[model samples]
Target: MATGDNLTTTAYIQHHLQNLTFGLHPENGWSFATSAEQATEMGFWAIHVDTMAWSIGLGILFLWVFRMAAKTATTGVPSGLQNFVEMMVEFVDNSVRETFHGKSKLIAPLSLTIFCWIFLMNLMDLVPVDFLPMLAQKIGALFGADPSHVYFKVVPTTDVNATLGMSLSVFALIIFYSIREKGFSGFVAELTLHPFNASNPFVQALLIPVNFLLEAVTLLAKPVSLALRLFGNLYAGELIFILIAMVGLWQLPLHFAWATFHILIITLQAFIFMMLTIVYLSMASEKH
Candidate 1:
């Protein structure tokens, strides 16, 4: 018999969101299970698999749309998809121009791809939190699997690994730009000198250590900040949806209202991430 106190809504939702771990005990596991299940039970990898699948699918779809639009483009009159893609391209081009002064033949396209890819990934938050997972469960059950263990989180941006991976990629780009613009010696000089120039050799020796430490910390902090910002916002939004859903099926009106409000969060996070990437790249392009 289940007691109402034991069946608290918060606990229920938290349990659903909990990662499935492997081992005899829940606390001690030989390995982390992809979905909630015992080692004896067959695991459904496809539940979590769809999140990446959907993100890549949408990215490719957009790429195809833009490619086709460009292929059929005309000088006389641009209509429909061509105009829409052109507007997006121009918008990204302007951002690149504003942020990066050097030749950006590669950077412009990269920025455009980042903007569209991240926006589409963030847009996954707009989908009903349980919809895809539920559909996935149904599909799994058809293929002779238990529905209860089909755990999947659709919003890739909400995943810390995903967001950190993105930030680290940006970090790599920053390093690459720094090295490309300024040679190894120039890069080391940026870290040690410029901002604080010491007239005497003794003063320069004292500042070298301090300057290097500051630059090192700043470089590390950039990706950490970027990762946490996106992860925190998206994770919080996802948690809110889970909580709302746990408040009984009758809370449909409130759920709809919250979901409507979350649209702003989804869009804002995408824009912030994109803007931050541009800012970081701009900083890289600078002498300092």
Candidate 2:
């Protein structure tokens, strides 16, 4: 945690968790943050350079692997990469088929992409928590930046913003499909009606407001839960790794033990995110 220095426990944790932030400063104009305090003060307009870089790079890696497999396909027995790709595709396709009630060409591919992309991001957690950040620090020193100013969080899912961005995109899809399957009026009715129905016209009108309030909260909760679930799990895992790293020689066994267990967590979180997306979209497509 000290990175071979005398950093206090809280400072060590804060340093590892911080993202390399870039944005405008009221005093310095546009510049990368030199401290966590400065980054927080930069407000909503600031960008996490490392989170964006790692996420986009991993995304491209996902596309390249799949593209290569598709291009190198054969009717004969498949190579290792082709076989792995086929199994992943088949797994996602089957998951979608079993869960999604409505027809959509987009769902299977979307599920596959979500599963693979998020899994890749979570997989970064298995890397030694301090490894990349230390490397990032050394690199920064070469560029005349202070080691303390160099922050790099390898796992994007640990950042709430990254997770929320993904969940909100899924939420947008849910809204899009709901309006597409049900007309605008049907969509509005779906939100405003049901869960509280009445034969009396006056009572039904009164129930509309209550129903809308409940349904709106339920609708908004989908993305909020989705984002928090992934972020919380990975962030906790990362924090533990940082704690374990502070132990001198014992870190080796402890780290591997945790990493072995973490494999399942990473895979399950990815599957859960993808599965929930399918379920939400399927619900959106329903006529009720």
* TM-scores for every candidate against the unseen true structure: 0.83, 0.97
lDDT against true structure, model 2? 0.94
Error of 1 at 66 (Å): 1.8
Per-candidate local distance difference test: 0.74, 0.94
lDDT of 2 by residue, 168-203 (tens): 999999999999999899989999987898989999
- Model 1 scores a C-alpha lDDT of 0.74
Over 135-197, each residue of candidate 1 has an lDDT whose tens digit, in order, gives: 766886797766555556677777676778889999999888888888878888888875567
The worst-scoring run of ten residues by lDDT in candidate 1 lies at: 39-48
* Candidate RMSDs in order: 4.9, 1.1
Q: Which ranges of candidate 1 are over 4 A from the true structure?
A: 1-11, 15-48, 194-196
Which structure among the candidates has the greatest TM-score?
2
Clashing pairs for model 1 are none
- Model 2 scores a TM of 0.97
